[model samples]
Target: MNLRRLTYLGIAVCIASVPVLAVPAQPRSVEYRSPVDLVLLKNDTWLVVANQTSNSVSLLETKSGKILDEILCGDHPSAIVACLDGQHILVSCAHSGQISLIQVEGGKLNEIHTIDVGFEPTGLTVAPNGKTAYVGLVATGEVAELDLVQAKVARKFSVGAWPRYLTVSPNGERLAVGCSGESKIVIVDLIQGEIAYSSKLSGGINIGHLQCSADGKYVYFPWMIYRSNPINRDNIRRGWVLGSRIGRVRLDKQEYREAITLDVPGMAVADPHGIVMDSSNKRLVVSAAGSHDLLVYRRDDLPWEGVGGPGDLIDPKLMQDRDLFQRIDLGGRPMGIAMARDGRTVYVANYLKDAIQVVNIEDRSILRDIPLGQRPRPSQVRHGEELFYDARRSLDQWYSCHTCHYNGGVNSKAMDTWNDGSALTMKTVLPLEHLDRTGPWTWHGWQEDLHDAMHKSFTTTMQGRPASPREADAILAYLKTDRSPPNPFREKDGSLNESAIRGQKVFAGTEANCISCHNGPHFTDGEIHDVGLGSEEDEYQGYNTPSLTGIYRKVRFLHDGRAGSLEEVLSDYHSPEEVSGTRAMTESELADLISYLKSL
Candidate 1:
C-alpha cells in the first residue's frame, strides 16, 4: 500500500495515499457555493439559496433545479427569506453585518441594495406587510428591525446572548428569537416594541432555527440537551450524556413549554436543525444535521403533553410506531428547509454535498439532489470537514465534533468526557479556532500530542471507533482552516479603543498580573496553574491557561462555567486578589479590563 506525508503547522503527518488538488496559479473569480439556507420565490417557480462560503445568492429553476444566475452579496450569507410581495428577497449576511435586498425578475436574482445593520446579522424574517423585517445579530445579542420601505435599519431590540434565529408571528404582532448562547427563546412584542418574556430551556444548547405556526399560536425549534452525568458507555447508550430534542412553546405565555426527545434507545438524532411544518400542521419535519438524516413526525400524533421523565424524555413505546415517526436518511448534512405550496414537497439545503435536495415527505423518499454548481476536486481539508460534521463517526450516529464545538466554536455548555481520569467533572468547551496554537490539549493540559488527542476524542469521548492516521491528518488540516471571526468590539480598522489601550497597561502591570499567564501570540502561556477553583472530585490539580483570543464571543467564563460574564469572573471567581494575591480590581478598572479583553 502506498503512503503520503504532509506537514501542517510544522507537524509532519503520515497518511494513506490520497489525491491532492493543485492550487491554480491565478486566483479564480468564482468560489464554491456552500449553501446554508434557501427560500422559494415567484410562485415556487424559482429558488434562491444563500451561498454561505461564496458570499452570494444562487437563483435556480425550481422544476429543473438548474442555476439561473448567481448574484454576489455581502459576506457570510447565513439565511434568506422571501418577502410578502414574492418579488423581493432578504438575505442576512452574518460576517459583513448587512442585509442584501434581492429582486427577482424573469427568473433572475438582482442585488438591489445592501443595508448595514450590525455585527453578525444572521436569522432573518419579513413581516406580513413586507414593510418591516427583523434580523438577529449574534455578536451584539440584539435584533435589528429593518424598515424595508427606506431600506435601512429602523431600530434594534436587545434580546439576549447570541440571537441566531428569529421568526415573526403571522399577524406580525410578535417575534420569537432563538438565543443560542443563552439557550432561551425571547419573545419580542412588536406592537409594544419590547420583550414580552423569555422561556428558558433547562439543559438546552445549540438552539436551532425557529419557526412560528401559521396560526401564530406557537413556536417550534430543535435543540440539544446535555445531561450532567458521568461519561460512560451505559449512560451514553441510554441517551443520558447528550441528546436531541424538538421543543414547542406557546407565543401567548411563558409557562406552556414542551419538548420531546428525538433519540430512541440506541439510535439517536444529533444536531437537529432546520425544521418545517406542513400546511395542515400535521407533519413536522426536522433536518438532523449531525445524523445526516431527516426526521418526519406526525405532529398531531406526538405525545407532547407530559410524556416522559427528566433524563429520559421519550416514551419507549413511541419508537415502535412507524406512523408517528419516520427517519429519512440523506447523505450530506441537511440544513435549512423550504416547503413548496404543495406541502408534501420539501427542499433542503444540503451543506456538505453542495446541493439542494428535494424530498417527498409523504413517501419519505428523496426526489433529487440539485447540485448548485461545479465543485472543485476533493482535498484533504474538505474531506476532514465532512468527517468533522459526520455523526456516523460516533456510536449509533449520536453526535459529531460539530455538536460541541459548533462551527469550530464553543457550545456554551460544560461536558464531562472522562478525559482526565475522573468522572462527572464537567469542563466548558474550548473553541477550536486556532486550535493548533493553543495546545497541549484538554482542560487538564495532559495530552501532549495533538494526534493522540484527536484519536482519544473519537474513541473515548464519542465512544466510537478511533480515527485512522490519515483521517486524523485530514481533520487537523481542516482545523488549520478554522480561523476566529473578526472581533466586533474592535474599531472598523481593527484598532483598540482608548479604554482597551489603557487596560492593556493594567493587564501587563503587576497589580493585575494577567500577562504572566496569558501572554503570547494567541494570548496564552500554554501552561497550567493553580487558580484555586478546583474541587474534591477533580482528578487534575490545576487547569490549563485558556487563550483570551475572541473572549468576548463566549457567554460563560471559567473552566466549570461558573462565571456567567467577564465581570463575574473578575469579581466572583478567579479575581486578581485570588489568583495573583493583588488587591481587588475597582469597578472602573474592571470595566476597562473587560473592554480590552473584548477587543482581543
Candidate 2:
C-alpha cells in the first residue's frame, strides 16, 4: 500500500515472465512516477501502492504493468500490506490517522472499511496467522495491534520514538520494529507481548525497510554509515566518506558486522531506501532512492573485499568478486522496492514523479516506464521539491538534499557541516519542518534566518556552489508546507487521554517548572539554554530550545545525539532545567509524562 496511486491511465511494460536472474533480450529503463511505499499483493495478481501526496491507492495487474484501478483514500498514506487472506489490502494514512481496508473481490478493489488506528501511522506488518496487523504509530511512539477479522484496534503498546517500519520473523514468534527515532530495532516476543531484544545500531542507521532472512537468523536493512561524531565532508569528497550500507544483525545477539555496503572510493550511492530479498534468499535487491537506481546483489557472490574508515560496512574478505550483479538506472526518486511472487520483476515507487518503474530483474533492464498518474502542474512547491532531490546540484552528483533529509525528515545523524567555521564540532541535522519559526537555524543557532543558512548549506555543507536567492525561496516554499503530523494519542474530539491530561500537569506544573522556556504555539520559546549540558570540548555551552511539536519523530535528542529516547532525555540524563524527581519518578508516572510529551 505504500506504493502510490495511478492516474486515469498507465504505461505498460512487457508481460513476458523471466525466471530468476534471466537475461532478457531487450535492455531498457523507464519510470511512471510518485510516493511512500510499494507492496506487491498476494499471488502476484495485483500491485498495490500508497501515494502520500496524491491521497490515493493504486492497484495494477501483476503482469504487463497494466492499471487495474486507483482508489481515493485519506491524507498522506504511509504504509500498506496485503492481508494473509489474500483478499484485503491495508493502507495506513499518516495525516488522517486511519487504516483503509480495501477488499479485493473478483479481481476488483473496493474500499470496504476505514478504521481509525492512530496518528502518523508510518509502518505496517501483518501476522502470519493473518488475523492481526501491527501499525507503527509515529506520533505516539506506540504500535496499534489490530485484529484483522474484527477490523478494529485491539490494543496499543509503547515502542521507541518514531517507529517507522516493521519486519516479522519467519516463524511468527518474534517481531522486529524499525525504531527510526532511536536508530535501533526493537524485537518483540509475540506470545509474551514484551520486548525480547533490541539491536542498538550506530548513528545515522535509519533502518528504512527491514527483511528477515529465510532462516530468520538475521535482519537485513539498508543503513547509513557516518561513524565520526561529526561527519567529515573531506572523506565524502574522496568518495569513500559516507557509506550506504546493507547490514545484517544476528537476531540472536548484538553485532554491527556488514554483509554488504553501497559505498567505496568513488561513485557512492545516494539514499538507499526500499530493500527486499527473494523467497529463495539467493538474491538481494535495494532501491537507492536518492540516486534513482536499483542495485541487485547475489548472496552467493558477496565479495570478500573489506572497506575501512568511517566504520566499514564492507564484507571482510579481500577478494573483489562483487556480489552485486547489476545496477539498473531507475531515473526517478525510487522509494520502495517490491518483488513479485514469480521472481521475475521488481516494482519501484518513484516518490516524486508519480510513477512506478518496473524492472526486469533477470535482464537487469527497466522494461517499462509506467505512470500511475500525472503529477500536479508547475508550482513553487513542486519546483522546490525537484530541487531538493536534484543530485545534479551537488559536487560531482554525489548527493542531494533528499540524501541528508530523506524526504524533508532527519537521517538521525550528526553532521560536520562546517557551518560553524569550526572543525570536528559536528551538529546533528535538524528537521526542516516549521523552520520559519524554529530559527535560529543549526544546532549552534548561528543563522537567524533561513536565507543565510541556505547559502551555507549549499557551499559549506554540500561542498558545492552557492544557491541563488530565487532557488532558496523555492526550497523554503515547499518546506513551509512540512507541518507536524497529527498526534495519534489524541481523541477524535481533540481531547487528551486521562493519563496524558494528568501528565500535562507534570509538564506545565510549578513542580516541573518547564513552561517559562517551552511555552508558545510550537512548545518552544526559540531561545537558547545552557541546561547544565555543556562539555569542555564543546564550542558553545548554550543550546537552542527546539520545538517539541515533532519530538516524536526524533531519533536522538540534546545538543548532540546523546539521549536516544524521551525517557533517557528526562531521567537518565535529566538536566537541571528538567522537572524535579524525574529520575526517581514511578513507572506509571513516566509513562504518563511521556504520553503527554508525545501528544505535543
Q: Provide the RMSD of all predictions against the true structure, rounded to 1 decimal.
A: 7.6, 7.9
The worst-scoring run of ten residues by lDDT in candidate 1 lies at: 1-10
Off by over 4 Å in 1: 1-30, 306-317
lDDT, candidates in the order shown: 0.84, 0.71
Q: What is the lDDT of candidate 1?
A: 0.84
lDDT of 1 at 171: 93
- The local lDDT score (0 to 100) that residue 6 gets in candidate 1 is 17
Candidate 1 global TM-score: 0.93
TM match of model 2 to true structure: 0.83
Per-residue lDDT value at 296 in model 1? 86
Candidate 1 local lDDT, residue 312: 63
